[model samples]
Target chain A: MDKFSLFVPNFLPCREYFDPGNNNACPGCGLALGVRHVYKAADKAMEKALWENISDTKFFGIKTNPSLLKIKQKKNELIICLDNEAGGSLRDALKKQMPGMAVAEGFKYVATACPSYPFDLYDKVKKALDTEGKSYIHILCPCPEGWQFDPENSVKAGFSAVETLAFPLYEAVCGFYTLTVKTAKPKKLSDYITIQGRFSGVTDSEIAEAGAIVDKEYSKLLEKIQSSYSYTFETTGKVY
Target chain B: MEASSGFLKKMIKCSLIEEGTAKPYKSGAHRKSLPEWDRDRCIKCGVCYIYCPDAAVYRLDDGFFDVENQKCKGCGICHSECWFGVISMVEER
Candidate 1:
């Protein structure tokens, strides 16, 4: 109601909302956790910056990666598109990742399950703020009351939600899709639902069916993310 | 007619609130478990800052992280998510 965008790149507002543990909320009630986690959702003063320098010789540069730098600087950086124009392969590979000289080409969509862990949520928000179009942040808010777990388990639930592949974290820009977070081992769907209180009555067959569905959706996401950029160098008439 | 006129008058007389003057929220009471941050063990990973629902964890000027006593509701998220074991949840007596 108050136009609150609580750094949506950050984790769920599940446990921070109600805080049943302290506020005379019902014992074993998880609604409190959701409320408690979000208590300061609107408080900007509390934003804990994860890093000292978010940019390369600049302050508050959200999209600092080589891919996004092109868009930020309004410059057409040379891509290692052609093999002949490029130097020896081994030397090029090392310097390519060294910054400033990296290839900033194509559309990238990053899907990471755990926000602010391997990635910086502040940078993500800054990037969204700097961008000119309508952007959407999708957060999976679990109701401990409905999920039927200990209030403290909300964070665990979020981690497992990503690991189980039940809920995939992805960001799509324009038409490009990227899965930022990749789980080493995808757990079973039942493993995710078993901890929640509402899914207790689900049978094994139903879980198996749902498992197949999750796998299907995961593959579909990967397919979209794998979509590549095709470009031809005019001088060499080479397609890359 | 009178009510409508009054509403218009109020809108015209409205004053703007200053920005960045918000007070810290005092919500420490009623918390079941409080997070005790070990300043020495902290790796400054900012993990507590990210997972904290209430945004209670603050990054101090010296690169050290600390919790605001007034704003914390004892959610324990910071404690659970901290990889360095810097924050431990102690029950409120």
Candidate 2:
């Protein structure tokens, strides 16, 4: 009936599809919201494919950390690396271990940080999954309890993370980097860190240091995207 | 006529409550703010009712959308999802 209704068509009749009425999730739980967006997007994407063609296609769901050691390691057609900040480090480790997995093999590796940028993240993930080879999607879901913030501020924190460049929204398809939610003027790191109780004790110098890291990484992403011939051609259509 | 002291005592006694009987425990009490309906602004599209995580938003008998406060956790999903920007979260006094 409604546009939002289309996102959860099959699950709406159950009444507790996403929230599941009687759960113990605290009020303003951002993780719950993140999970809902991610799951709905993935499920809806899969459903569309199933509806179009039941035969000649198969979908398998695999839940694992980026650390290959945690699960029985095997090459998957699509590897969705859903993580918080801690999980991002693990993803980095996996990438370091297998440098050629994404670029040389042309595996779709999408690394994103927040659900507040849902459309960009979801659409990229779906596109990556649709491709032939292995794909990895990294999502950063902030925890209110663990991060020491009021549950209601979860969405705000998520938004702040992106705006402040603490979690730059981007996707790396076949080792090519592209910034998704490109803010015209990014906010300072303090704007993001001040909200979360976990960073309450962080000093001014520490914030600056973290800001430097974000800036460096962002510049590197820009350079990587700029140098790539495909990205250049895709954007300006005049390849060097 | 008031009840007798003996009957009052029996009524006060604690008993084993049924499992899962505490479903939908007055989440409205936890809300810091509640979504206020703007009838004039609302297009009666029912987007609020459909996207509400708690399913607290409902259509009234006259076909206007309203919130059942008892069920609303004030997640603000409706406020965010409303394309018309009709729903606004007002702080509870």
Candidate 3:
């Protein structure tokens, strides 16, 4: 079938696939935007692979959340893990559990957020999937309700999270780490927290403490990437 | 009794609803603000109609665009997408 024909079917209103108009997601939900970008990116990547005569592949989406622990049904529960809570990162946890799959950190650039960043990151993800068989993209999808922000400010809050260095933008492809979008000067953590209602009553000392944690984590990531370069090149047989 | 059971099974089979037929529950009650259109400045380009995710933007018979407040979730997508800047999201009283 023609590419357009395939694309048209996916766009058609279906309960299975993510439809634009009928989604139950809250207004300005970052997860909705993130999911949409992933689908669009995967579609383009699949089309490119088809044109190149590569092996046909299927896409499977899995949403991992620790909140599923409250559910009783097996079908309703997928993966139970604390993602961004209690000093635990989901990408690291997944890496430890499944040593074989490539874990990548997908992030949006403040300069080119939304449409541009998602598409760019998708291409990187598609490449990783083709080479490594499986890839996990840890996207930072902000919650307006939980974060206590107006729905209209979801995009702004998402951007702020990255700018504050609370969520660094990097990709870990086959154990190799690469910072996708580098910030010349990251914004203060307070700038991000003050806008959200959840952090409305937070004190300056608390903000400083959180900022310190982010800085420490970011430095650790940089050190890990630097130390892993030689090993990554040895194993992958290609310099990243 | 056997004939009644057979008829009940047939009715159950026929009662399955068609996919995509169920209308979404009204979401306008969730809106904190509503988009108001200024007809004097509207060029009727229909950009708002195309970009509305909730399908709240409707074109009147006279080529003027109107938002169905009952369906609008006050996402401000139409306000952002309007090229002529004729649409403004005003606080809903």
- Model 1 over residues B6-50: C-alpha lDDT tens digits? 998888764335543223324565578778878887666666766
Q: On a 0 to 100 scale, what is the lDDT of residue A14 in model 1?
A: 24
Interface RMSD of each: 8.0, 4.9, 7.3
| DockQ ranking from best candidate downward | 2, 1, 3
What is the alpha-carbon lDDT of model 2 when measured against the actual structure?
0.58
Question: Which ten contiguous residues of candidate 2 chain A have the minimum total lDDT?
Answer: A65-74
Which prediction has more favorable TM-score, 1 or 3? Answer: 3
Q: For residues A22-135, could you state the per-residue lDDT of candidate 3 as single tens digits?
A: 566677565655555444445433322211111322212343332211111222211111122223432231122211122332212111123214444445444543442334
lDDT (Cα, tens digit) per residue for candidate 1, span A122-198:
33333443445433233344445556677566677767877888666665554455555678888877777789776
**lDDT by residue (tens digit), candidate 2, A1-240:** 446643442333322234445544555555455555544555534332211132432323223333220111233344444344442331231122232234555655645646655556557655765665566555566666667776545666778877876667776666767677888898877787778676677788877777677777667667877777576698889753
Q: Which DockQ values do the candidates obtain, in the order shown?
A: 0.11, 0.14, 0.10
- How do the candidates rank by TM-score, highest first? 2, 3, 1
lDDT over C-alpha atoms for residue A85 of model 3: 25
Off by over 4 Å in 1: A1-121, A228-240, B1-25, B60-64
lDDT of 1 at A58: 33
Model 2: how far residue B43 lies from native, Å: 6.2
Interface quality of candidate 3 as DockQ: 0.10
lDDT by residue for model 2 (B1-93), tens: 256876766666532245554345555566788888888877676656654544567677786788886777777767876778888999898
| Candidate 2, residue A210: lDDT | 74
Q: Over all chains combined, what TM-score does candidate 1 have? A: 0.54
